[model samples]
Target: MTFIPIAIYWIIALWGLFSRRPVLVYLFFLSLPFGSFAVVPPALTGGLTFVPTPMTAMLMVGRTFLDPTILMRAISSALDVRRLGLLTGFIVTALVSTVFMPRIFANRVMVIPVRGDVSTAAPLFPTTQNISQMAYLLISFATVIMFSQILKNARMQQTVLLALTWASALTVATGMLDFASQYLPVAPLLDPFRTATYALLVDVELTTGKRVVGLMPEASSFGSLCLSLLCLLYFMRRAIDHDRVRAFYAPVLCALLIAFAWLSTSSATYLGLAAFFAMAALEWIMRFLDSRYNLLRKRYLKAEFAAAALAVVAVAFIMLLHPAILENVSMMVDRMVFQKTETSSFEERNMWTYVSLNALVETWGLGVGIGGTRASNSAVAAISNVGVIGGIFYFGFIIQSLLRSAPPDDKRGQVLIVALRYAFVPTFLVGLLIGTTSDFGAFGAFRYGMLTAIGVTGLYHSSRMRQRRIAVSPESA
Candidate 1:
């Protein structure tokens, strides 16, 4: 049954590969969330695991190379050569370390795990797994760059966002169905193939029985993808021209995504949710203050004050009836946030961090190798796997890109860019706990790459627009 979607996907993908119209390629990008079940058969391709997203990325990169003009234009418009050089240096350093680093350092073992306990162990040097990881990273980087070039104008950007919004809506609907299937006897008939795929890919023990894995490999992964889409939708809403139907569906989709994240029972999702709401609240306060002072509207001010008072009263009332009324809330907070620190999972991550630090010290900050240690944290992984020199280039490239992609004076674009930048704060902080910079297979990396490309492309267009405005009105400037 899973073969059905896989077959249809290949049909479309092949058409896209051969067609002159770019719409098919855009459709392929938007449909990546559905690719979890579109896996290639292990018997073929020498037992190499292949998914549609990465396969499509490889095709796109090949297409770019086929047209040197497109590749050169994209590089010139979307990238700063200096930053590109730094990125190249980082990649080269990793390659060099993989070749030169020792296989065994005092009998220490380096394991590269894809999911759960399934992993490949090697010594300090790069194994086949490490090389595969490097390939994934390069593919991901090329994919983002190609998409950024393709989505140059405002119309293209809007098209991509609209496609993304629809895709997210579908994903949320599927997740809700998955959750309902747990209780409904006839739910299997609604999504038979997806249900089967979930059974095949999901680790039942880790999901805690109630969490919905959706179309992703696990509940946590689905939650991460949802969180990322939510952030994108929130920012893109401000930049795109509004439609009544889209406006109506946007909030409903957000509500569904939030519910799905909560039901996934991932602590990382909870933390991200907390951070998002905090930023939203802060933005709301700033807007309210700005309106109050600039517009000087007494009615609006009075309404705002009344709302604040009501919130205060509600909190006080809840506190007064705390023991019985808030027991469930307190218990949830304890389980999701507080008590998590005492769990074995937290201890394991701590142990990984300690080991990574020791590796860094032992190697004199030169790193062990590309896949030498399992740090479970991006910053630690950078130091331990890539060494200090590579880490500097790696982090430096990201920071420089963010700085260079500052939005121009367009109010809507500025607001969107600012929000997107703030959204990255929580994601980056979370990565320090359980992600790597070069983890190409994860949805988080995909989201990060997409966001970065959007910022850079938006800034490029915004700068051009600003220049035109200046040229038109020299006296005003």
Candidate 2:
């Protein structure tokens, strides 16, 4: 079964890598939902299950590195210099932490490993996890450079956008099928796709109904996937090139991803959804203010107005006419968010964060290294794995990217810069609650790269399609 999925991935990966078109862009985005499908079996990797997206990321990095000019161009810019510097500092911290901190605090701290019996935290030690996690961290860091370089070309940027739109649609479709298969006799039919060595929590449930794990190993991951896509698609829709994709496909997929995430019934997803609403509201308000006061309006401002109006009408209708809908929503939120601490899952996850944070302090802030501990919080996971210096470097990179001021002429760059910033918040907030590793995974690196490419090129001069100018025959100026 694993072989079946691996073979399919190979075809996609190979085609993407070798093709003239930006197939690798499509491959990267489409491969993300298969969190449970480990491309390399644990037995082959000596207990490390290398999943598709990370493997694809490594391949993308390798492919990018093959071009000597990318590094040449990357290093020429001050923004790229800082990005590389910060990431270099981050990796150095991880290396030092993996080598020395694990040994220094080996028996001194307790942690729940990313693998092994996750039921309880144990005294930390040097393990294979440290090595594998370092590799993953390296791959993620490399991905930022790889993708940023790739996005320098206008065609590649458009391809990535299209790929994300399609990937979101595919993700929603697969999750819906998974949800429907529960009532049908076809649940086992989909099992072949979920052959990862990790324990698959596909059929977990809350008090209401079966949690929609999709093809992911667990409900939280599946929900997070949906939430991330929803944010990306909604926030970055204007950057998409095609009218059909931007106006119809992306919007429909966003609605479906939102619906599927709700069905997943994850507490983190609920919090993320709330965060999404808040952030979207804040962004819209800011844009509105910018348009009214500063004359710094966005390209598709009317859509935001229309969406906001629809949301109000929908909410009013749901409250006034379909009161039961509001009651059900309230109960869901109650179970998932307000009363989340009461659940055993919450207790277990809480322990993971507690022990991870303790490991941080226990190591005197040296950090126990990546994969030395499992954490339910991204901040705890990031800082605890690499210590304060590494944490600062990692977070500083994010802030730097967000703070980048694009040239006034680069409209696409400016939109992507602002959109990606807001889009990251919902998912990052969710990761703070249930994230396991310091790695932001591939999609995050992709977003970072997209933003970085603008900074890399400085003015997006490689873009051939941004112009609709008709030249006058006589006038040179």
Candidate 3:
């Protein structure tokens, strides 16, 4: 049953490849959030499990080879000696660790508990699963490199952002429908399709009885996706043309996203949202203070101060008249935040982290293998699986990519870059909790890769444009 969608996807992907329309490839990549069907390849059914995203990534590699232009460009970009060195070092270390280190340190079997069930043991070693995981990780890295070359146009960047916005809206709508299914008959109609897409379970809040998982494997994953997209949408909103209808609808879409995030009821999502808003508010406040003093500024600040005063007064009134409301809020926070540390899920994550560190120690900092330890944190997973050397290269590549993508002199672009940079803090924190090195595969890697590529490309073009202007000027010479 899962193979059906996988087969259909390949059919379309092959058509796109032969037709020389790379946009089709890009579209397929963008649609990965909806491509969760899991299938086992007949040839290696016992050894390897195939997911649509990794399959698509392999197809993309094939497409690149078929089109020499893309291959050439990717090769040219790779010629940057430092990036090439880092990438090569990382890949070599991962391969060596996966093949040799595990066998050398074969004295211990690393046990990682599965989520939802604490007693079940999932052991890790240099098995076929680890190899397959390494393959997928490599594919993800390759996809990011391919996209950095392909998504050079500002228009393409806008198109990708618009596509992501639509996907987010759809995810929120489906989630709402899933929630309504508890009380409404028609809502269940959507479940079959969702199930086929690999969303096997619906997560419901115990307190509110509201369903939250949407296309993702779990509620927390869905919430994480929403938070990431929300931050992206907020930063990219200004880039959209104000004269267009999308601009009019953009705020509405943001509101819907915010509502979806809240409805997720995931603590991590709440933290991410809080961080994003705090950064945004800080930026706004700084901007407000820096602007020339005028009647509008004074009135705006005065209104803000008045609103704060009113909020305090209202809070006092509530404390005096409706003490239960404050008590309930505190209880809710305790349940949602403080109490989480006592849950089995929290224990499972901590166990994974502990096992990961142990694995790192067992390997003597040489690493066990990629996917050799089921650590919830990417940094821990990287260090434990690929060794300290590989970890440095892996994280170094990300930092270098971000630095290269730094916006130029354009004020709006610079502001957008700052917002995007701050957004990474929350994403990183979430990754530290329960994210893979590929950041949950193409769903995360591709989106962030495109954003970085777009920023870098835009900055390059901006510099070129300025150079051209200066070259044309007579006074400068």
lDDT of 3: 0.63
lDDT of 3 by residue, 1-477 (tens): 444655766677677667755545554545545533453343556524465557667776677656788787667655543333465567778888888876776656564522223344355445665676788777876776666666666566556566666666666676677667667785445533343322255645567566476655667777777777667666555555433524455556666777777677777777777777776567557646766433322223444456557867988998889998789757766776779899997887788788778878766788877756667777887788888888898788667555544444444445445556655766677677776443236644554455455555445657777887899899779
Model 2, position 85: C-alpha lDDT score: 65
Poorest lDDT segment (10 consecutive residues) of candidate 3:
292-301
lDDT per model, in order? Answer: 0.61, 0.81, 0.63
Give the per-residue lDDT digits (tens) of candidate 2, residues 1-477.
557777888988898788766767677788888888778767877767787888888777777777788767655532444445676677788888899887888788898888988889888899988888888888887888787777877777778789888889889878977988868887776787887777899988666788998889999899999999999888888887798888788878888998999998988999999899899889888786674332233655687679879989989987998889888889988878999889898899988999889888888888898889988899899999999989998888787677665555777767777888899899988988888899887867887877777753323433322332324334434
lDDT of 1 by residue, 1-477 (tens): 656766776787778778876555565446555535545654564545566667777776677557888788656644464325566567778777655653545355444333334233333544555665667766766665666466545566666667667767877876877777677764544442342222344434332356776766677667776777776665455455556534566656776887788777777778888877776567556656664232211113354457558877997798787756477656666786788899887777777777767777777777776656676687887767778898897788667555544344344434445555656665666667666435534343334344444455445667777888888896976
Which candidate do you rate higher for lDDT, 1 or 3?
3
Best by the TM-score measure: 2
In candidate 1 the C-alpha lDDT for residue 278 amounts to 71
TM-score of each: 0.79, 0.91, 0.79
Candidate 1 wrongly placed segments (more than 4 Å) = 20-35, 75-79, 102-125, 185-209, 286-326, 405-412, 440-477
